[model samples]
Target: MPSTNCTTIYKLVQRAEDDDIEDVGNQLFGDGSSTMSVLEKKKRFEELYGVVRPDAIHAHPPNVVKCKGSGSRLPSKVEAAKKAAVKPPRRCGKCHKMVNHDSRNCDKERSKKQK
Candidate 1:
């Protein structure tokens, strides 16, 4: 056999390994092996399949507080405490008297004028 240099043997082994890898890749993926890189493959895939956009599934409505009338402003801590201390009597709409139950479910005797 002719004398071969170590560099020549190394080059041959490297070429054989590369060819084996290419052959296995060609077997796995189809034989139309383009010279495109990984990034190029990703770009082509994006161009063909398009990108997916995520949907807002957990979206929520904005919280809003509305103020109406002259005394609709938020009360202070001291004013709230005083209002809580002096609990006003609830008046019934039907009987027009201070009662524990509301007008909707009042058991008071109706007057002749109301009837």
Candidate 2:
């Protein structure tokens, strides 16, 4: 079975060319899976490197905080959250399933039986 460290190891391989590659790799492998908790990793890297990582790591919405709600409020909150969660929608023009995901993400409505 492949270890969870596979990803960190793969990254070590990919980033081997960078100046800080050795330091990052050492941090990752030194801690078992080298999978630092997201917050810890972010904090550590920002402290050490003096730069923020990419949007993939930091894209959580600022105004969003989770709390319990019920009934109409829950649905309304969900709809509003969805609106706040907007990314450019990736619906396929042909089938309209979020084809941006993978072929499996192809929309059922969009997938027609071709004769």
Candidate 3:
């Protein structure tokens, strides 16, 4: 007679094999229907499970803190200031050129140095 653990493992293996066979069948017969194509079934699978397997990874809220009793922390004041201080890449309106600053502050020599 087989042990309980052995029987459990055998059942798991059997279920996995059955799933594999069904997957192969789906690929060959397009989910047991001739109307739907293999590509459609693949697209459906991707839409259901974004990138990771639903069974393998547990879903969690993005803002949830892992540490006990501690709430989600905000960015430091310095970090926030640094982010705010960052300017978008400026383009010269007159010459229609990409430069460090707008047309009013465009430095022709400095632009040459960049190249």
Query: Per-residue lDDT for 54-113 in model 2, tens only?
Result: 776656658975565643534577787787567565756555565343345455433554
Once fitted onto the true fold, the runs of candidate 2 whose alpha carbons sit more than 4 angstroms away are: 1-20, 28-34, 51-115
TM-score sort, best first: 3, 1, 2
Rank the candidate models, highest lDDT first: 3, 1, 2
By TM-score, how accurate is candidate 1?
A: 0.25
For model 3, how does the per-residue alpha-carbon lDDT over 43-106 read when each residue is reduced to its tens digit?
A: 6667556663354677776896568857767999999878856866566786687654566656
Task: Mark the regions of model 1 whose C-alpha exceeds 4 Å error after superposition.
Answer: 1-4, 32-115
lDDT of 2 at 90: 71
Per-model lDDT? 0.68, 0.63, 0.71
Best by lDDT: 3
Error of 2 at 91 (Å): 67
TM-score of each: 0.25, 0.22, 0.28
**Model 2 scores what on Cα lDDT?**
0.63
Candidate 1 local Cα displacement, residue 111, angstroms: 99
